[model samples]
Target: MQSVGKPTGSLDPKRHLWVLGLLAPASALLPSQLVTHTGLAFFWWIGPIIVLIVIPTLDRLIGDDGTNPRDEDYERLSNDRYYRWCTYLFLPIQLIGLIIASAMWAGDDLSLADKFGLAATLGFVSGIGINAAHELGHRVEHLERWLAKVALAQSGYGHFFVEHNRGHHVRVATPEDPASARLGESLWEFLPRSVIGGFRSAVALERERLGRLGKRWFDPRNHILQAWAMTLALFATLTLLFGPQVLPWLLLQAVIGAALLETVNYVEHYGLLRERRANGLYRRCSARDSWNSDRLVTNVFLFHLQRHSDHHANPGRRYQTLRSSAQAPQLPAGYATMIVLAAIPPLWRSVMDKRVLAHYEGDITKANVLPRKRRRLLAVRRAVA
Candidate 1:
């Protein structure tokens, strides 16, 4: 929980920048070729094998970067063209990767196992596709924002462009925020609420924006609709070019991508709440409101997204400049590890509930417990007392 003034790491981020591109070809080439050449079906599970198994293992082995960049270095880091181009390169790589994977699906003579491998690998692309979009979506430039939509179009979840920036960031950690997971709610229960509810929130947010402009909900300037329209167009073209066989992979990959995003949302503020004053206004978000991780490998791949507190507090800051905080609720492991652990409700609850309680000093009611679990949580608190 100790805070460092600057980020510390031995890895030269400039040299390892290509690590972000590793995901581009994961689905497009690696798995199927490895399977076909080796004649082993084990490679079929490479997607989960890489995301759930490999990354988490490496995260533990390599540990985290805890030091912040020096105060003087912030200006140079912020102005670095290398970091900007890294995100800009995302558009072609993911777009081409998707096309290549679809071509493989259409032309390759492969087994169901091969198809599954492709879908899973593409799912990882879908997940990282949105991750890249997230970094760009926070930018103010018109081109960067358009590229955000394009990146999201790859995953068919373009509404995130609107909802995340306008809604989730504004209402986060409140009961009203779909992206914020409630305590005692399992990941299974949270996923549908977050996905379906998040989309609805996006539309509502768009309606409100258009209303302010004296435009109808269907106005072309309605960013939510515009983003979705782009997604529909892309999907239509992909289906037309690749035929129906590609539909299942496309849909499954989108689902995996969305699920991955919601899982991250679930952990970022699970059981945390912003205090409301007697006047009925919640306190502004701070480091304490969100969970943070500093694991180095995943942080680099994710563009330092694990530094959630700073990102939320200063959404305009470039990822390369995001700093770690001492006050935020710290995760026991890196994001990849936490995301996997979240899939199992019992283990997730067992591991995280105690931390939540400790954060609140055993005051159960001060935290955001699920409605159904309130009485039980209170009873447990009394028993412990």
Candidate 2:
């Protein structure tokens, strides 16, 4: 077996497999086809079933390949248009799936359960598509950035393009970073805070940028509004074409997609903190500040997002070249499993709290605790001392 740390040289062994990135959106539509032929309502939920169950199971069985590309290979891999096209393909497929879902919702034959199952299925696709957008949004290319917003339209999370690159990447793992979940914060609490705070921060960051360029805060040049306009136009056009019957389900799926995206946000930096200097500046982000998982299936599905520690260190790095870090904290499993764990607060805390505490060398003060829980954590710390 190849050592996890050893580079496999110039050729990326996984080169041809990248087309699997489209598997999520395309496979999701497959079940609806099955439903059409077999009249099985359960087919609608296949997307969620695959994400919540199959992916995690496959992750466990396949395990992490853990091949960090040789430094020499980075340029070649990053410049590979093949990988870029794989991600670019997701946008059209995702949009088509949403349209198909709308057509289904517009039909009268489906039961309410079937309707929600289909909604959830598409929600999973759109939520994962946000990961694709994250990959695209970080690039210097103009077309990729535009497609990133198009991918986000299904989730109604267009603000993510501005906030993630500017706000989350800039302040990640710090107390001021709303995207980073605190030690005592559950997925439920973190979702609304991150989602709302991110939107506000994106607007402010864009306004500040525009102001320096002599543009108004609400100027047409604000890319944040541009992204939102794409979403609004998409929803309006879909409603007009599919009729009002598809509108409510469209909104429902959007909520689920956004919720899933925020849940991943909750997982990425839970309880991690970047120390501030005496001069009041936070330390520069490094691998240790973000969670890392090398699970191969998820690394593929999410386009190497689970190699998150490297991502923070190289925010603009192409996903194809993102490396696994030996120093970064490792999750017990891939994001597929951890995301499920995060949804249940007690389970999330039970599994992750000890890791955070250990990462800080058992010093509770070093972790970012939820504000209200700090006193209680300190009391327990004193008792242990």
Where in model 1 is the C-alpha error above 4 Å?
Answer: 1-15, 18-27
lDDT of 2 by residue, 107-158 (tens): 9878899999999999999899999999999998999999999899998898
The prediction achieving the highest TM-score against the true structure is 2
Clashing pairs in 1: 6-67, 6-68, 6-69, 7-67, 7-68, 7-69, 8-67
Tens digits of per-residue lDDT, candidate 1, 307-366, equal 898888888888888878877778888889999889999999998999988888888887
Error of 1 at 27 (Å): 4.6
TM-score for candidate 2: 0.97
- RMSD value for candidate 2: 1.8
Candidate 1 lDDT at 369 equals: 86
